[model samples]
Target: MLDVQSGGILLPVFDSVRALAFVGDLSMGQPTDHSLRTGWIAARIAEAAGLDASIGDTVREVALLRWSGCTANAAGFADVFGDDVAVRLAMLEARPGWAEAREAPGDAAALMRPLAQTHCEVSGEIARILGLSTSTETALRNIFETWDGAGLPASIAREEVPVPVFVVALAGDLEIFNRVYGLERALELIEQRSGKRYPAFLADVAARNARDWSCAMDEASLADFDAALITSGMRRDARAELIADVIDLKLPWMTGFSRAVAMTALACCARLGLDEAAQACIYRAGLIHGVGRAAVPNAVWNRPCALPAGAWERVRLVPYWTARAGKQTGTLREAAELASYAYERQDGSGYFRGADARALSLEAQILAASVAWVALRSTRPWRAALPSDAALQTLRHEVASGRLSGDVVDALIAEAGRSVGRPQKSATQNSLLSVRETEVLRAISRGASNKEAARELAISPSTVRTHVESVFRKLECSTRAAATLKASAMGLL
Candidate 1:
């Protein structure tokens, strides 16, 4: 694998992307290895179809990342449909009544087109961020398109759609439908979608060999899929933030939640006199602690009233899923394990494993406390965000109740009180953006929509759009998440 240096440390591109893909699976309410299985199926299909070797590799990539854009439009899904996770799972499995539900409110095509556009754009940007081949990126941009020119964001169709797109689409269908319905039913359904979702020839290829492919996939190892990724790896400097950004997108109010927790945890680690290695572990854990959050539906998260017992049960399993997904990857195993403990209480009052203080490490204690602090300060649908002093009081209450460690709470509170100044104007002097563009960048980086940024700046939304386009051209980015990542890395925001 290639290496990219960040503060004199090497970051694995494959590891980071694979980790995000796991979260993507959770977002879609699927098992953690869904993408890996799809990738394997797509590669086999490509090879059997006598495609070029490079095209086969791209097919694998497109399959693995086909759902990477799910998180980008998660909130929109929640708005249109009550439970984003359940709706998406039904959609993918082609369950009865899903189409009716999608069209219940209004025109499904009109409602879905914008959401699809956002998903495609963000996913394509993710491919660009990983420095994947242009072909892979292009294929991903049209991931939802179909052979009949009827797909969402349907700008291209038929021969204009890349071969990898159709291959991956058929492979994904084989993987999901076959597993959900038996092999015969899966084949029947695929046949029904032929000449619509994909070409009839591709459906014929999959139907004839799906059973063998499914058996082979069941026997294949994770190593087999990762082998291709390692050989064609691309490195990047800011992979962790990519995950945090996508995770937060499930809820608009939760933008940058993980990064805030990580930064706070890092400061608390320093205040607690932890070693550098321990501090780094805590920081990374904070960034990914909410990976399990993806498994919980946005509707559940944004509930306006207290969750019922059943909903609470689902919420409690959030960390369980995080820990389970962690074991699927090597590089992220340790951090993900620690992240899974974010909710564990010192008094054995927390969820999903409910280990008491004696079972918790200091790093886990710090991470948990940091998550609590950040959540208390962030606004939620059920309650207004607590002020800093009030949030600190809540933490102290947890400490008094023997649920949080007093030492960790004190360290976090100390870090919270510390002040720092922003980088000087010189930091942006070389960014080559005008003052207005910089303002727009900073606003959007903070999760402001174009209209919100325009409202804040007392300008029209159209003007905001113009500035956003200009910013994209100047920064060479296509999505707000990408621009935000680049701006943060460059200290321009």
Candidate 2:
């Protein structure tokens, strides 16, 4: 981890990148760290083929951020295909010309073009907002572009595609194939798709050296795999926290809920005798366990009345999304998995899986109790915040009735006495924005692309995109128009 601590805070480039990748995986219906593994493969192929270190680094960054825009265009996707995740998974599995068929409610081109464009634009905007290089932004915007001009929205062919984009694209498919099939099939598939999806040169390279990449993927741990992608610079942790900030905005009253849960989880960890790595995992997992909340619509979350049967199923998938995102995050997989059990009960009464005592781990039990503790203390639209004593009594009753574990509830209550506060942002964080998001919000107000704001600010286009993304998340607005209105009302502009 590159500390590059400015003032008192550790630069969070690492955490933000990995966490975003994890969330991005969930967005794409992939396991967490899908991008991370792709990045590692891309970098190695670049190095083995003797591409410069800069190209390798660019590929890594591009791969990490490839799906950051998945949520940006989610509403558009849902508008066409009801279930956004299901549609995306289908699209990923679809072969060439599959979209030509009328499988959806609307014309595929009409719906998909805008969605793909939004995906590209928002991703590029994020890169610009984060101050990444122009090339990085270009690669991100062109991630869907391919050799044969048959890709989404833009459809730029071969030479028009950025080099890093080429590498990351091939690497992504190879990772999917290699993981799903054996090494030989992964290599053969690369050969099959060479002319159309990826460059022939890249495919040949991946095919020839498939074993090495496959071996590394088979052996690497999340910690080991991540350590290799380090690029020297002042990386900030703002984006990492900002992602959680966005996810929490799903419900109007859920502000700061993730941070509170994270703090309580860490507090409970002290009593569990967990190792430092385990504790850190628990904390990160808590922070992002709600990342999937973005998939659930606000109407369902804010409904004062009971959800209809249809709405109930979507509600059930919320924790599934969290666990899915966490499972893809190589390093945080354990913690993410544990945190997903937050809504579970010791008896077969919890949601999603309805796991009982035999299924839930000690860490999962602790995390669930912590999440309940925070929810009880926090104000919800339906009720006033529970008094501490009342909350404890209620939790105890749940435990006695076989809903929650007695040991976990008791430990959580005991941990409550040693109260801790949420982590604070540094005063040195960007000034005009007060929230690194304001810049992106302002850009949206002006109707600028990531490229436009990057030119004006003289920063990388990627940085602008990243900031705009953060703004959308922090403000909880989906469109530029909505974001602009929210910003003005809040006096952010």
Candidate 3:
């Protein structure tokens, strides 16, 4: 039996982290290997500076994870800059005009503080969940801090910012600037910001040997990093659900969308009498199918009118990036490859590859149908979510048009119907809480405020408060955020 709320699939820690780094790349408007290259550069910088071996390892992790929180604050960026991807890319490249544009007409720091806080908290939480060292978590939380006390979310100066933060900042600047601008210009820019952005000594060290480092990166392969670059050992498999959660965060309204698709795909597989291995593959594919979604900016996705040719081309490449990321990931490669076909059609009209039914695997077909079903039932910025019957009718129309497999659509609709209003296992059976308290926990886990949960549950604010307190007490957590994290780990959410 598949638990829809549980994202408990096992994956290697590196595979999950690297896949997430791909998401970070898309969110930052960089290529898929941008984080990987950043990690390599940071490790090299730490080595050249004669940092401890342990610090070098942590530097690699911090560099790869520097942009981990980008998804958490993407909507906030889109709100401020209209095109989050473009604005972030400009900021990274230090394009001559961005400083003026970034600070124009308002107190940018005041507006950026909250967004930075959200990013740091979420990044720190992800590190903690991965069971990384406290130092790594600390570095991630202060990733945006500057040497001069001008950074947002606290304005902590000099020694307060973690060493890995400085190392990664310089490494990122080297990676981005060296690529965007040549070594001479990149070195000059780093020299100018030396005291303000990072320590002057580190910048000098980089300026002296940046040419050699860039050449080494060009010649080195990812396998070389595995043998040479030091990284923390992950003894056990991490949860794949975290990947889904972070991917959905790129579009806030789509929270839980990946898990829904995964669970529905699993249910459809079972209904279709697929074997357990096939079911797991389909479920994993469903969760990761949206990895490419990060490549497109939030602005393009939010547009109400029909997309122009260029925008439509970007939309079609979503699964292409997902597949590309999977090919780079060792453990989840198969699932990722299948995930890339989530948009294919039976009649050969789908995107990124346009493979017909003959070329599509059964698992791919099932996943494609599952994605369509869940997407139809979920609301988007341009339209309200279709009700269940309406969603079903839409799928039926697709099936009739020869674009979807009839059997797959029927199985999905059956699973969805059976799941509607189904009573979940009681909280008493899973944890020490009443049914109402479980409901409150679920509501808050989705980021609802007490008043909002109260309104949604049709109970008074005080009653909601009572249940919330009981939930926190029973969970032994002092804050809603802590409670949510604990509950998610325990599969209570």
Candidate 4:
């Protein structure tokens, strides 16, 4: 069932993750729905092949996570390949001979050498940071390893490799060929590569399971699978926060990024003396502002070349999704509307519903400045992270161009300086509520019942209930944890 609270629709975290993976696959050079569809296919194959449920679950996980590390070195890729998106698409189509051709002892070799090195190192780093299980980590590291030990660093041979890695790689390639070529051609290619680049047994398994694979490819079923896999929680608010983290994980440089932006927005709101409810809304909205990026392809996002018109249109849809995701939630609607204008220029140029300064909300204006500042500091395929001075200069340029408000820019610069001196705190602080209400809300945020909150706080269950009710009323909230997030944004607790 769709979870709804206070007229807010909350997508489950796993469902949200599936949405993210779908977005990543479509946006990046990987095949469309490749990871997720492959995951569904692998799960079915494992079931039919008599694997245990645990093994099937692991296979599914490995398939989803296998290519997650690809974005870690986007900046390096942009540097070596000129256009990161184009390079990835080419890599997808590169034959073994073509790959080797790029390494033939000259400028080509020098260029492709860094690309390969970055791919391996960045993949490993991303896997480690995401806290994948040891087995999952091993699978990601050896994903490019060939049966002949000709693939990449460490080049481990056939029998030494993990089974999930082998299965995932086969699934990924087969899906691509099936989409680009035909089903028959895909089968022929897999059959041809059996016992060479791919394991003979896995290839045979894929061929035998091709029909079932197609059955699993039904878009409706994939959506159901997403719903089934979502992490369970009491309210959508908790789920939303988890979704934010997953989205941020798409690129290594963006870890905890949305939270940072949200916090800064809240701080700015405080400095400006906005009301507590509006401040809370700004904080939550900031954390979710980049949710639309999931819909864009990784190639376009990391592209070094200027985007073509159609691709640029897709890029603009990101803000639309951000607003769309939050529109059903009353508390988040205003923030989402504001965030939709996050990319707007002070002079009126922006996208997905562009509005100039007169049309911009204060929260949106603040968000625009914060997002730009963070992007400047984050490594991208086109450029290295700028120094603070350079980032400031860029911000100043935007101001000059009327792309950003000068007041907003100045506030962000001040916030950036302050951030450097202090250890970063939780983006949502529990300060919006009073002490008693905060205590109740915190317990509620942890999924505590009124009775549970009372025991934790050493107060009567009735008193706890009253405080919970008060928190809801005071923060214009209907749920315990949303109130907690409000408190955090306000730094009251």
Candidate 5:
């Protein structure tokens, strides 16, 4: 059996790409998960139609990555089209030629000229930064291109366009029509685009295979699908790493966020005189604190102003989801719980449960301070990145307000003192445990039954029991609660 928590390590990366896809789909004026479902459906359709497995894989990857560039220029998009998310969503339902006119007049040339130019440039840059292959980048860049040479860059068309691009574009549009209208309306829309916006052959294939596509990608449980995919030979290590990467991709400022947070928390624990083993636990917990943000919508995440009351409530659930997901893995349960308090205030005003300072775990306090310091230095929708001095001042104010721990704030400020002239980016320290030990520890943290932990980690129950005993002994604890408390106090949670 594979370690479930280990499997989750990939979620951070996958979720990031998925989040970008969601943002792009939503920003383009489609419903959330529209693009994902389309990509899933496209891949399934290609497989069902006997396209090569590799082609199906590429199609799936391309579909998810197609709109990745949208979030890279979210602020810019908002500037050009007020309420960026709304404008893009509206574009999805707009009549042909109406989108262009909304921007300009019968001067179609001038009207679409800038939007197309901006879309291509921004989209390409985003794809490149996310480390996509050149071919993938090109396909993404040409996602808006038509069968005629009338799209952006004004050169590529028909056979000149990448097959994956063609597949994704056609599949996405068809999925949208099917959801909003019906089977007949969707086929009609595809027919309308047969030789212009879409390739006739692909359109015909989609129309012919519409039933299979619909059945395969309908509203099914993503959790079950993800499990099946994993069991069907998805590399556990790769999947975990990918998940981590996606979580990191949520905010540009958080590119290596989990690692940095883990490292910083460990360093802070060390500075406070925690033993090496306890510090290791803190570091691991820090690496996975934000895993739940994957479940939240990008609109609320990238909103420039105060969120609507309902949206704000949804935003607050991100931490709760993170903890819930972590609990599923068994190794990061404590870390997940602490992460739930990341947005919490010492004044007892945080989301989910708002335990005040006394009830807050030490790990939670350190995480709260660390996240605040890091976020202040990172760019966000509501503000620009703050200079170190300003960020420190803000942290100090929070401390004074009883929202952060005085000790942690002081330790972090002291850490900042050593880097007076250096940039204040987030950083991660080395892992305290060997790879195998970390795996065992992750399972232990989840409160996994010894037998279950053994099964999940592919080790004997006795071996798991031995490791658990060693873990408790090394951390100088007699029970799980004792170990958890010690870990939290040491900032390992």
Candidate 6:
């Protein structure tokens, strides 16, 4: 299962570090080959530092995973930088002190302290779970550390740090900077930062061999990095599930949301008599469907009320990010596509592409229905859990309204019928929505006047007007008709 033929070289596909590096590359706003480049450079640095070749793979592993936790603290980063990817790219461009001194632009300690801690925690845990070396895990935990003990999460000073870890850190920066700038400028920057952020020795070696070292791994097609890793000997199959675990931790409430969705989606497919290949794809797709959630900030995702139009737009793009990252993992491409379609609706109002029912595949249809079924029964900040009957009514209502596929809905409802009360994962990230807001929006969509909406919702007319204004503003419309349209598009109705 690991072997894939790419450009006539048999390369292992999606091995742990290789797969994660692809996702990390996207999260860091670097190319998909970033991790591979860094790993190659780090291995060379290790060799030059007089380290033996026996543990060569460990050096590469550390480099590949240095930024593996990029997604874990993304919301915190986005909270300060507006766009997490942009902030990370900018942070990399400016070097070590940039965040606290300038890029943070807010309460740097308040925002960055937690983010730094989270990066180490998540990356270290992942390395441990993957059964990587104790040293590799240590290296990942200290990924942010500089030579002068300035890293956050922990500031373990020089001697406590392993030499290989230090070498890998320098290599990652060297590779990135070398790629962005020509070899000369890259060497100049490293020469400047020596003894401060990086050790002078590693910089000296990198500077001397800058040209050849930077281009050594370039001739190999990007697809072959996994092969090189596989040749180095690591397994690849369980990577999707492992990545799902990482994605699940992005939100406190969504701890096991993706696994639940995958399981439920598979039951729907199995009930409909789909093939095993189809079943496997949907299962994997469900596991990482919410990976995109990491790219969206908690400030928007954790709102206990309805989101404004701009926030909703950001919410819609979550699936796109997932698909983009997934595509980079060639082995997961199909599964990723299914995950991307997780939010599409039959009425053509769903986003990231707004693909209508005609454009959606059977897997997409089933995934969407399964996601909706799971979401409706899960509790959120805005409301109590919907009872089975109420959740079913809500789902059925969508099918009747031509917003979802009837066949897929029937299969999902059938699975629900067969299953007993199992714990549901948090269905959707909805701090950006309020139950009251949805109720009011639904009423308005049906052309209810403020007084009419108030009467229906058991609120005063003045209070209803306040909610109406809030809805109008959040949805970014000046009129009731536009609010109704936007709400329908957002599935708030």
Q: Compared with the true structure, what per-residue lDDT tens digits does model 3 show for residues 360-383?
A: 988889999999988898868788
Between prediction 2 and prediction 5, the one with superior lDDT is: 2
The stretch of ten residues in a row with the least summed lDDT in candidate 5 is 228-237
**Candidates 3 and 6 compared by TM-score, better number:** 3
Instruction: Order the candidates by TM-score, highest first.
Output: 1, 3, 6, 5, 2, 4
Relative to the true structure, how large is the alpha-carbon lDDT of every model? 0.80, 0.69, 0.83, 0.62, 0.61, 0.70
Residue 33 of model 2 has an lDDT of 68
Give the per-residue lDDT digits (tens) of candidate 5, residues 324-376: 55433434455556667777878998777777988887777877788888778
What digit string (tens of lDDT, one per residue) describes model 2 on residues 330-382? 44566667767878888978878999989988777877888888899876656
The true-versus-predicted C-alpha distance at residue 211 of model 6, in Å, is 2.3
Poorly placed runs, candidate 2 (over 4 Å): 1-11, 95-107, 129-131, 181-188, 233-239, 245-287, 292-493
Q: What would the TM-score be for candidate 6 when compared with the true structure?
A: 0.74
Considering lDDT, which of the candidate structures 1 and 2 is the better prediction for this target?
1
- The Cα error of candidate 5 at residue 186, in Å, is 2.4
Q: What is the TM-score of each candidate against the true structure?
A: 0.90, 0.61, 0.89, 0.61, 0.62, 0.74
lDDT of 3 at 34: 81
Q: Whole-model lDDT for model 6 versus the true structure?
A: 0.70
Candidate 5, 71: how far from true, in Å?
1.3
After superposition on all C-alphas, the RMSD of every candidate to the true structure, in Å, is 3.4, 9.3, 3.4, 14.6, 16.5, 12.7
- Per-residue alpha-carbon lDDT of candidate 4 for residues 8-117, written as tens digits (9 for 90 to 100): 22443343344345434533566445676677666666666676665565566667655543443444455454444455655665444433322134555455544445
lDDT of 6 by residue, 254-277 (tens): 544665788888888888888878
Query: C-alpha displacement of 162 in model 3, angstroms?
Result: 1.1
